[model samples]
Target: AAAVGATKQELTLSIAIVSLFSLLFLLAEPYAAMGLGLSDDVAGAWIGGTVDLTGGVVAGAAVVSARCEEVAAIIKMTQNSALGVYILLIAVLASRSGLGGKDAASPAPPAKGEGLVYGLWKKFPKFVLGYLFCSVVASSLADRERGIAVPLLGGVARWWFAIGFSGLGFSTSFRSLREQLDGPNVLVHY
Candidate 1:
């Protein structure tokens, strides 16, 4: 979002849209997959592809079956690998379009031979590598170890998410939310 020069309002809008999409996809995919006589793994993968969050994907898959959870995790992780590329593309487009502000235009364009690969490297999401590394380590563990590790890691993730959310809530001023709520179109938009 920072690379794209999105304001707080745009980030809020993005979150709202993501929430709506996650809800609709979570509710709709299972039944649709069942109607088509798809297996749980396939249905889970479908849900994984649609949902961006790992926890949400796992929850949606678990609604169908326990095995679906594992399948969904793998699929979601695979899907998430593309996020770096997605962000890089967005950054490049933002730069080209001057969406990142006037400073973006001050730099000369890369040589023709330099191409997108060079630019993409500069904007790539490094966190993805960490995710991939953890995934590899988890996969390499013994079944018993993995059984223990999964829940432990999940609990830690939930704690971190809670802390992050609390920080965000603390940082946001109620006055700003109230002002947005006061807008005549807020209700209609919601």
Candidate 2:
């Protein structure tokens, strides 16, 4: 968001719109797939890829079956883990290509091989690091050694994920939302 100079509200609105179909897709896909005589794995994978939110994908898959939940969770996590790489690539390209606007608060380019690391580090999104770290810790902690703590950990993770997803709704501006003015802005997120 910083690299592109997007405000928190803009980011939230974009994400919320993109994920607006998640709930509907989740509720319909499982039964629809079964009615079509599709396999659980195929249905689960479709739901996971189609649903933008990780927590929603997992929970919705569980409603179908354990196998479906496992497949959906795997696909969703893989997609989530790809986020850091995607953002990093965008950062690198944006920095090198001068994509930002004139008002963008970009740092001065360093001399070749001088402060390059620091420059990249400055451009890097720190949230991606934290996100990846939390994912790793959560998976690592999901071992059999956790015993009774597993359910607690799962609940906490779900709660955190739900709160994170809700940032979209909470950050939305009522003015724009109520006025329904922003078809162009909405298309830009695509």
Best by TM-score: 2
lDDT, residue 180, model 2 = 53
lDDT of 2 at 76: 94
Q: Give one digit per residue, the lDDT tens place, for model 1 in 42-151.
A: 88888888886677888888877887778988899877777766777776885566443224322333445766555444434465666667779889999999999989
The residue ranges of model 1 lying beyond 4 angstroms of the native Cα positions read 101-156, 166-190
Error of 1 at 152 (Å): 6.0
- Residue-by-residue lDDT tens digits, candidate 2, 96-148: 75443333344444446755465566667786887777567656774665655
lDDT of 2: 0.70
Give the whole-model CA lDDT for all candidates, comma-separated: 0.68, 0.70
How many angstroms is residue 10 displaced in model 2 relative to the true structure, after the best TM-score fit? 2.6
Question: Candidate 2, TM-score vs. the true structure?
Answer: 0.71
lDDT of 2 at 131: 72
* Root-mean-square deviation of Cα positions for candidate 2 versus the true structure, in angstroms: 4.2
**CA lDDT for candidate 1:** 0.68
**At residue 143, what lDDT does model 1 achieve?**
100
Q: After superposition, which runs of candidate 2 have C-alpha atoms over 4 Å from their true positions?
A: 101-116, 134-168, 177-190
